[model samples]
Target chain A: MSNKKIGCGCLGCSIPLLTFIILLVIILPLSIFGVMNGAFGSKGIPAPKVELPAEVIFHIGVFPVTNTIITSWITVALLILMALLVTRKPKLIPGRLQSAVEAIIEWMYNFCKDVAGEVKGRKFFPVVTTIFLFVLINALLNLVPGYGTWPITNYAGHEVILLRGANTDINTAAALAVIAFIFIEFWGFKFNGLGYLKKFFTVERAFKGWGKVFHGKLSGFGDVLFGAIDTIVGLLELLLEFVRLLSFTFRLFGNMTGGEILILILFFLLGFAGFGFVQVGYIFEMLVGVVQALIFAGLTLVFATMASEHHGEEEH
Target chain B: MNIFDKLAELGFSWPTLVAQIVNFIVLLVMLYFFAYKPVMKMLDQRAQKIKDSLDETQKIKDQAAVAEQDFKKRLEVASKEGQEVIARAMRSGEEARQRAQQEAKVEAQAVVEKARQEIQHERDEAIGELRQEFADLTIVAAEKVITKSLNKNDHQKLIEQVLAESTTLNKKA
Candidate 1:
């Protein structure tokens, strides 16, 4: 077959092919050298340090601002800017940006509605969507290049990176966990009123059992036993609610830090070989980021729904 | 170990947490006003517009159907009226033709009756003249046969009486 029949046989095809060949030729030796250097420990490149704490970039009054806070601000600015840009003049017949913005919001709205009933979903939508977007954008933006590269000398005369992943910082995670906790409890109280406290306090069952026991009914001992168990269970439930804050904070912080470290280690190990392979870690991190964001947001939604439910009403 | 010290070891600062919380609240508020509310409103508005337009289209379709029915009804009425007019015109034409025929027949019969009367009158006058000529001729023949002069008035009376008797005899036969 003629070249024209076989392929495009044009400069466009040849140019990319030549570029690929050249890149392969260059990359092959470089990869081998990188592998050799990594194996032999030639001290050519130092291993990257894994820092758990976010470096304080500056201070406002007594409050020491960290790099993660800066990143969070950047995330907030980016999100707000995008929101404003897309929704400046919303049209019935939307443009591309408007359509994308609407699709995301609508998807989140429908998700909330699906999980919670319509009335409760409307109440939960803002906080749930905010948490999802905040976590998601913060995680995704952390993967962008130059986040950990820009070093600046602080007022304390210590060198620290200017920006870090917001989720990597314990303080930010803790803040989000605190917010989620507060909102969950708030919604619980709002929906179920003072009866919400009954979820954690089972004095009524025990009180009834005590009253029966005082009336000289021997079978009331069974009720008393069960009531004590119920009270303990309620106490445990209360403890679990507090424990959720710690879990929520650490889950995000651990995953984000581990992802960052994992990518760093991969880059250090493979050196030039990391060119193609490190992308795998990045892809993994991206998936982890999306999953973690979803988990954080989804858990908060589930917890809030559980909290708002009238537990005592179901038994009656 | 102090719990605060332990928390500090893990890089959890109260000020930073508070700042972050404040930041998040700011973000949430901003996003609510800028993104969620407008987008949700726009979506609802679009849905409403679609529903309204669909309803309008259905209404217009229904109106078109009603108009078509009305037009068909009117067309049927007009056609029925046209047929009735045609039938009425035909009836009037038939009556006019019958009336003209009856008048023509009467006129033709009148003309025939007048012609028959005129023919009878002419025949009677001609018979009277023929009878008068015959009388004159008989008189002249009697004068020739006698070959002498006689009273004219007496001969005339005798001839008239003879003629009257012969006419009566003809009538009897």
Candidate 2:
């Protein structure tokens, strides 16, 4: 036979071909059948239990320490460790780790600058970058092999997973949302001073129209009607501002929890098949992590930009 | 049930929220100091370094171009000066040659003039001698023709007078 034929008449070619046949024709089917028949000391896959509240593992002075809190602390430590490693002795000509770190920070900085103007973007960059790194790392680390599998006994002597994604916890999401809200309002007040309140509590036009009516100008009723509409609109704007806190919190919490549940369910449903197929969900989760991080940071930047601007002034 | 009860059901605890907030704030501060500030400073430093190097290169290039032009200018001046020196040498050679020819001509003319003056002097001396001999022969012939007719002194006086007259006539002719 020619060397160009299927078999190269050498040990190297035959070994790989034989391995492929055994894997695809024999082992793959056998594994699938074994899993289906509950063979090889295998109990059938259990139904995935979806938990909403992060389980409390311990208490510190009446404070419950949940798995999500532990995970967030790990995320914080990991981030700080990376920062220290890359920045310990920064070189003018960067090495790989330094370059990667710089790329991430610079990209986020530029994103903030693009969404907000230079001065405001500079002010907002730290908070935005922090949120992004914290949320993204938590999401990605949740997909590591030991995350949902490492069982520990809580103080109540009940078994629970040691680590969970922080973003899946509503409290962490709310905390982030609360911080974003505070900064947005703070920037608004800082840039526009007390005039920032005029966007929500517009009473000057109504007072002026009433003064005109006292002077007996009948057409002032038009101004009154318009001012009333403006006031309602301003109230709506105010209500939406508060509503942003809820939306931001739920959006992150829901997406992270849903993605985790999705991977868990897919593994349970596919069993032997999931070894290869569940990687799709992992890739999708990674993409979702990145996108969610961007959305969270980008929205905060946009809102901060909007807050810092004067309401009635034309945007440059 | 109230909204507060619903929020509790969703696991919204004040302590966890506070802890997370504090955690985020700490991270923001740490990252700002460690990562953002140093990296930005490095980037700016790199940019400044590149710009300075580029400016230095341009300066060096300009200096090289000026040096080359100066070299070319010096070469041209040297070549022109060389040609001037050669032309001066050739002009001085021609002048020397002409001066030597003029001096030779004047010397040859002087020699020729001196020879002519010497030849004139010799010719005058020979002519005087020949006249003397002729006068001597004519006197002897007259004495023979009138041997006893007159005394010797008288013949000598007469011959002298004749010779004087003939000399005057020859001078006139």
Candidate 3:
């Protein structure tokens, strides 16, 4: 057989480029003018205002249950029902739903195993997977038409959005971050015992080493200075733990809330023209939602694994 | 204004946070039991079953291969035994035929020797009787020829001469 290079030539690339140019030059401008003239007529599109706070849907005892919380509750319920459907009568030979669920779980398990080693990965799997599912499902709820558009009650004489993404609520994001932080600390204590405290308060080691100088183990001025610096760094590391909590909260809250706000703004500008733009934004938001979920779950598992390990050991 | 007030303006209610925490905890617990645990268990069981089936198939194939080899070996042994039996029978048959031929030859030779001996004895007896009659006839002929009563010595000499002549004739025949 003769050796031949099999690849698309310049013609293949030019065809798509030519098609794109034609659309951009003709169809795109025409469509924009048509939407502006036909849809808006004389009335121009209005300026949009983004609402940052979640709307209160109801009051439960002393707590004001927001629309985001309601959406989360529904999401959780649907997720639970899906879980029951898949696992109700599990067979060795799986059905479509069961197989899809199994594939997701297997993927998560493998991902966790890569982030955390096998033993700790199994321990962290459920929490990490739950966080991913909750975030992803809650994020997807934002894309539904009636989610934020449906009016519930009058807020300051204007109708308010009834449903919102759960993670867009600062309280929910903070809660999730706090839960993850608690689990990280718990694992640190469980694995390292009293040594876990030394990661934050390592100044005691300097004093201990000072005594060790008499025994000729750490018998240098440089060693003492280095130990002091190490102690200060350990304190900084302790501060960073709080930073991690803040980052986890704000990152999720900002991304989800920003996407919602961007969609609203897009809908306000150019009226009908913005509809196609919002569809594109929705797709981007969906991707961002999935990415955020993976990042959150992956980071939590990594932090948990790191907390459980000795600081001095090289990771395997 | 306090930082707490500023945060509260951002929809940060302590009660709502607590409720959200409760909600997350509930979600986590429910998801763990209903989704993660069961799904992982089913996957593990399915994996185990697949492994077991593969192992079982491998074991059966190996057993079949072993049985095939055993059958082949038995066939070889049976064919070898059959060949050996035929070879032994042929050898024994050849030996039996040779032994029977040698016995027949010996028996015939013994019978022929016995019959020849008997024939020789009977011929010798007949020859003796003929000799004796010839002698008596010769003596009577001599007496008649010599009517004048010749001597007994002459008659005896005549018989002996006739007997010698008969022996010579028999030798010539």
Candidate 4:
């Protein structure tokens, strides 16, 4: 009953606050003035830029390994290490790290149970929770000092930035959305079997009770027209499903990338004067990160639950 | 260039998407097996342990309550029995007192009767001696008055008549 979440002991909670203040208030202005006055000589201030595409860090055969992918790998490694550390010794009475980890998973599990019914909730719980953590971690990783600031020479002899937010990359977001979409579809098939397709194609519903319409005579026209339109609407809805993929991808990619660009521009233009603005932006970006993660997971859970249910299984 | 061309220029490679998917799947599988499963299992076990201990405590409490009730019931019975025993002893004591009182009264009556009988016998003896003394006195007096001897049959008849006259005189007095 008294279980509390204690932060990882390695870094104090104030470290992040201290880091932001030092970077934005002190180092930024100092670098700006020093560079403008030619204190470092030759080169002027290296203005922060947001590269749209993640640069390839290295190659394995013909395949290009990008910096965002590397960041993702780092995220995965850190998460796995954290997992191992917390779970190394499991106890009935959980310690700080274990309690913190359990609290988060418990919250996500409860959220899933609330949105999806208990049975289907557990079925999609793993993927939904995973997506949430991955997105949230990737989003927050952008706040790190050296993240997306590292520069390296590619095999093409051009300077390419190394290490960016994984979710900021459109490809990564697209892949995540695709996976969620696929799972939603899979759950739809699993629960409703062939009946799941009826939501997408209304051709069968169009023909249903056609005999009654004919027997009623002359009134058959209304039913035919209604059915046709209904089928057409179903087709449009089917098309919209693909649109969902694009929206999911862009929503995550735009927010993260836009935040990155905004931070860069604000830091470059205002320097010290923009400290308050940048802080506000940073807080906003953090909220957005959590919100977007929640939305993505929530949407996936809704879709999975919807897919698993029959058309008239329950009232709205 | 249009939007599609711009997107193509952004390195929207299928290979990269596939790679990212593969990376994610690997992460999912790893986390599910190593992290989520073990942690969830431990949490469930802890919950179950707590529930079982709570149940055991409740059972013990109920048993204790039952024992307390039994003890109270026995105490009440014992107290009732003690009161009954005391009442019985009191009743027996009352009976014994009555029996002893009746026996003492009877013994006193018997002693009084024996004392009365002894007094009567002593009185009877004293009365008989007195009567004999009176008869002897009368004879001596008669002998002094007459100064002569009488014949045998005449003497007996005269003594009898005198004795009868003396008895009648004693009764009248």
TM-scores of the models, in the order given: 0.79, 0.78, 0.73, 0.74
What is candidate 1's lDDT per residue for B1-173, written digit by digit as tens? Answer: 89778888878888889989999999999999999999989988999999999999999999999999999999999999999999999999999999999999999999999999999899778777766776676668666745765588866877688789668845743
lDDT of 4 by residue, B1-173 (tens): 87656775765667678888987898888778767888878877888999999999999999999999999999999999999999999999999999999999999999999999999999778877777887787779678645677777877887888889788856754
In candidate 1, position A166 carries an lDDT of 93
Model 4 clash pairs?
Answer: none
What fraction of the true interface does each of the listed models get right, in terms of native contacts kept?
Answer: 0.89, 0.75, 0.71, 0.46
lDDT of 2 at A122: 82
The candidates, ranked best first by lDDT, are 1, 2, 4, 3
Cα interface RMSD of each candidate: 0.8, 0.9, 1.2, 1.3
> After superposition, which runs of candidate 3 have C-alpha atoms over 4 Å from their true positions?
A1-30, A34-47, A154-158, A209-220, A274-276, A312-316, B81-173
Across A1-316, the per-residue lDDT of candidate 3 in tens digits comes to 1112333564344677756765566656655775667435414534555666777766767667788788888888888889889878887788888889888888999998888888888988888888898899889877888887777674345467678788888888888898899998888898888788888886655776686787787465556777799889989989988899889988999998888878767766645644457689889999999999998998899889988888663222
List the candidate 2 regions with Cα displacement exceeding 4 Å: A1-6, A9-45, A312-316, B86-173
lDDT of 1 by residue, A186-248 (tens): 999999898888888976777788898899987888888888998999899999999999999
- Chain A TM-scores of all predicted models: 0.90, 0.90, 0.83, 0.83
DockQ of 1: 0.63
> Clashing pairs in model 1?
none
Q: How far is candidate 3 from the true structure (C-alpha RMSD, Å)?
A: 8.3
Give per-residue CA lDDT, model 3, range B38-134, as digits (tens): 8888888888999999999999999999999999999999999999999999999999999999999999999999999999888888877876787
DockQ agreement of candidate 2 with the native complex: 0.54
Sort every candidate by TM-score, greatest first: 1, 2, 4, 3
Better of 1 and 3 by TM-score: 1
- The docking quality of candidate 4, as DockQ, is 0.40
